[model samples]
Target: MSYPSLAPYIQKRPWLMRWMRPLSEWYFDNAGYRKLGLRADDLIPEEDEMVQLALKRLSPKEAYDRVFRMRRAFQDYPYLSPLVKEVMAEQTEREDLESMVINKRKAAGEKKAH
Candidate 1:
């Protein structure tokens, strides 16, 4: 559900932000999650391990509020995105390091054989 965000670019230009603000508000309003009492973060999927970890990290009050909102919205429990991205980045780095080590070992073995 990741989409390109023009927010940073728009923020750098006051004129562009002023022009887009109304349209952005209109789009969000029309999106209708607010009508259901759900904030944008509530829509993030909970199936991922990173999202689950993020949920566990929530403060007691925030966790309660999240549950309340979901129940009120007639839905089930669910930065979620930022946490997920962080977890993914960590996983990628770990894998890259492991591959590098494996390659180094292989190259060392080849040198020995030669």
Candidate 2:
């Protein structure tokens, strides 16, 4: 990709530029770039509050349609590849670490009871 061609994508997502530059060069030199993952991942909602409000007022399909169209409009926006579920799992692990600390404190208290 020419510097000019890649400018917009880089501006939109600065983090990717570090990886994208090399990826693009290899893709162009070896073969034409293939478009993959067009529908592989789930798209996120633009506004959770707005979506919930509309869901109450409209039919389920209609509510979903509104959300889908908004996401489709900004599909060009950069997003992390991993799902939010994975991020939530990491968060739960952090909570478990805190719980372990609390449990250890309780165990110490119980030992002192005697």
Best by TM-score: 1
Deviation in Å, model 2, residue 57 alpha carbon: 37
lDDT of 2 by residue, 17-113 (tens): 8778788678655642123222211233425776456457877786676557556645745555466778998999998987884333465446565
lDDT of every model, 2 decimals? 0.83, 0.58
lDDT, candidate 2, residue 99?
A: 81
Provide the lowest-lDDT 10-residue window in model 1: 101-110
Q: Supply candidate 2's per-residue lDDT for 107.
A: 55
Q: Measured by C-alpha RMSD in angstroms, how accurate is candidate 1? A: 13.5
Best by lDDT: 1
In order of appearance, the predictions have TM-scores of 0.52, 0.24
Q: Name the runs in model 2 displaced over 4 angstroms.
A: 1-25, 29-33, 36-83, 103-114
Going through the candidates in order, what is the number of backbone clashes in each? Answer: 0, 0
